[model samples]
Target: MGQKSGGYDLNLFANPPNCNFVCSVCHGVLKRPVRLTCSHIFCKNCILQWLARQKTCPCCRKQVKRRSLVYVNKLRKAIGRLEVKCKNAEAGCLATCPLAHRRRHQDSCPFEQMACPNDGCSMRVQRWALAEHRRYCQHSAQWHCPLGWLQ
Candidate 1:
């Protein structure tokens, strides 16, 4: 009972503030949150700036404008009530974060690792730069030995 009460009380303050949505710009916690009549929501500043540069929702290819926009505090608060989890699929990371701001956790998560495609480099690298490393891995063994060697 105490835990439940605490959960509700904590949610009263927007306890969690992580979002799973990918930011269109800045790639941060999207400043000035906003929502549309279509139920699609995004950062107000992001939308406005996007509208200034181009008029359309990044997630949905629907027409959007500043005039048809409205603040969605209720939704935002509701989002805060949710738990966030690692976005790194395939990985066994079971971390749970808030619904408002899980992106940051996944982006900076340490468990997220990838194999170094260096023939047999046997190195675990972060997910983001995995492609570059794989492409230019010095350990990219040109010769394949029977004993399973990298470079």
Candidate 2:
């Protein structure tokens, strides 16, 4: 089975969400909800991707066309207002905010993972530890040029 996508994890919700807010495709909180002519709702990306493979509603199996998809703004807003834990919770970030603000929180979250900047390094370190990781990176100038030829 294809990995479910385009929705927040159910475990991220601070409280249980309404069944209406769950996407049938991903079985998680809807990200960008879209309604089909069949009256079934799914995350926008999930439905579109599914349509690309099979042009029918996964739930009702109704024949669906791309033009028949409609964005459900009110439902989207409702889902957005639901509280959710930070995606970096596992990385020691304890912040929680509305689902709508999750991206904003992640942008500044100290525990957010970031790619190493050193040209030859491929490590992913948390935002707060990036500087320290950079200083000790194996690709750093000091490690690559111990003789100080480049310094």
RMSD to truth, every model: 12.8, 4.1
Backbone clash tally (model 2): 0
Candidate 1 lDDT, 1-151, residue by residue in tens:
1221111222322233344432444344433457766666666766676678877777776887679988777655655546745655346565677755666776777667877866658888877667666666667655434466644
* lDDT of the structure predicted as candidate 1: 0.59
| Candidate number of the best lDDT | 2
TM-score of each: 0.36, 0.71
| Number of backbone collisions per candidate | 8, 0
User: Candidate 1 — worst ten consecutive residues by lDDT sum?
Assistant: 1-10
Off by over 4 Å in 2: 1-6, 48-66, 135-138, 141-151
